[model samples]
Target: MISNNIKIKTQDLNVYYGEKQALFNVNLDIHSKEVTALIGPSGCGKSTFIRCINRMNDVIDICKIDGSIKIDDKEIIDNNVDVVRLRESIGMVFQKPNPFPKSIYDNISYGPSIHGLADNKSDMDKIVENSLKKAALWEEVKDRLDEPGTGLSGGQQQRLCIARAISVNPEVILMDEPCSALDPIATAKIEELIDELKKSYTIVIVTHSMSQAVRVSQRTGFFHLGKIIEVDTTEKIFKNPGNQMTQDYITGRFG
Candidate 1:
């Protein structure tokens, strides 16, 4: 169930890559324990918007962001913020499943180990098991924990990545088109995982698939040309959007 509490808030958010602006005065509020989906055409800044939540854009030296991003009503855009700790609390799953070449167990244990969430081998073992179970991949790979994560099938590898994300016990999860590379069955499984995960973690997803947004999200924000055109309940956005551009886009008239 979605909480009334706001988990993340952004106001007047703008992004530029060497003077090429990517986002424009974006303002959004994400509710706690809910799936908030961002939908847009290509290059519309959907991915850029979610990346800002975890400060993933900092990797690009040319990128410059100026705005207010608050998590739990605390400013995160400040220079004084501990970025590593912020990222530990917000996990990200990218469009492609890029698991490390290490073993499946290592993949799940890596985050907890780095964060010092476990004291001993036994504690790490429990964290790995629980994370895999949460990701719905434990039964499939429990016997092959020593196998390389890259050895798994694409779907399994993606699940392994998800397990790694949750192993750190993040309060929020950001998925950038997580199902784009997946087959329908795999996509369904991931959607189900999102449904289950929303009970414990706030979720933000960027998707080009409108059906997917409707299926997995409680609230939807429509972005176009680096700006959010409309934001409302998923049902409202799909069935009765206030903006003609949004309606046209949803109806396949134009992107």
Candidate 2:
């Protein structure tokens, strides 16, 4: 069961890229220290919706957004919010593993160093070690900290990216189809990592795999054609969804 503690809240949220609108009236509450999954077909606004929470869409020249997404009771859509600092608080992991060309140790340390989260070299070392341990990659890459992050395998690279995202001690972690690029074994590892991560940080994942959603998320939201059809507990969303579209999608009638 999900706790009543809400870490993120969205109401009447909308997103547009030039003339094409991507989302419509998206209202959701993400519980603190819980995993919430966004499931939908390709281009159904799942990715767009998560981007709105952390203001990732602000980088695109054509993007425009309306409505409110609040974290810890503070509205993030307003101009007063410091986007760079807000991003440090809400870390993001992309669909593909995109680690910098730097060494593995530098990959994790860079964020903390830039954000001034570390006071010195020793603090940086501790942050890197802890982040890697949390991502379940410490033992595997501890000896190779000086090696290029890109030299890692697909799964390792993704995990390294996860370590980087958490190195700054973010409150929320947003994942967009994080396992789509990996093999089944790699996917399983990431899923297991996600399950463990929810104990410390609020996680919002956008995935196409319903089974993945069921495996990792406590809450599930079904999206379709630029709108959220329904949102509920993972079991309720999969086993007894209230909307016809949600039921059909879950039963594999159509994507």
Candidate 3:
């Protein structure tokens, strides 16, 4: 069951890529301390919608957005909105693990240092340790924090990215097909991490794997042709969907 602690809300949200409408009116409520899965075919607006939550869309020159998305009752799309602060409050992990070329320690501490979240070297070390621990990568990398982040395997690098994101202590974490580039074992590890991370952060994941969605999410939203067709409990979305498009996509009939 989803709690009443809504961390983010999207009302009549729409997106455009230089006159090409990518998302229609997308209304969504993401509860705090829960995992919500967005599932749809490629080119669907699932990824676009998640990017909007953290203001990543602002980077694309052709991308334009309308409607309201609120975080902690604050409008994120408003002109005076602090985009830097908004990004700090909402962290994102992309489909591929994009660790910096710097040392593993540097990767985790980068955000905290930039945001002035750490007071000193000791504080920075503590932040790195706690974030890596929370991301379940401490056991593997605790002995080699100085090594380049790319030295790790795909899964470890992804977790390192997660650690970096969490180091800022963001309120919400957006994952866009985080396991797509990982092997089965690596994917499983990430899935477990997602289940645990939900205890502290609101998670919104866009995944192509139905089983992954069913396993890790409390709620599911089905998208098709740039519109959300159904939003419900994970079980309901998989076992019984309200929309035919959702049902078809879930049953593997068609994307």
Clash count in backbone of candidate 3: 0
Encode model 1's per-residue lDDT on 21-110: one tens digit a residue: 999999999999999999988999999899899998999999999999999999999889999999999999989999998999999998
- How far is 36's C-alpha from truth in model 2 (Å)? 0.5
Clashing pairs in 1: none
Q: Which stretches of candidate 2 lie over 4 Å from their true place?
A: none
In candidate 2, what are the lDDT values of residues 195-234, reduced to their tens digit?
Answer: 8899999999999899999999999999998998899999
Displacement of the residue 51 alpha carbon in candidate 1, Å = 0.9
| Candidate 3 lDDT score relative to the true structure | 0.94
Error of 2 at 88 (Å): 0.4
List lDDT for all candidates, in order: 0.94, 0.94, 0.94
Prediction-by-prediction clash tally: 0, 0, 0
Query: Which 10 consecutive positions of candidate 2 have the poorest summed lDDT?
Result: 246-255
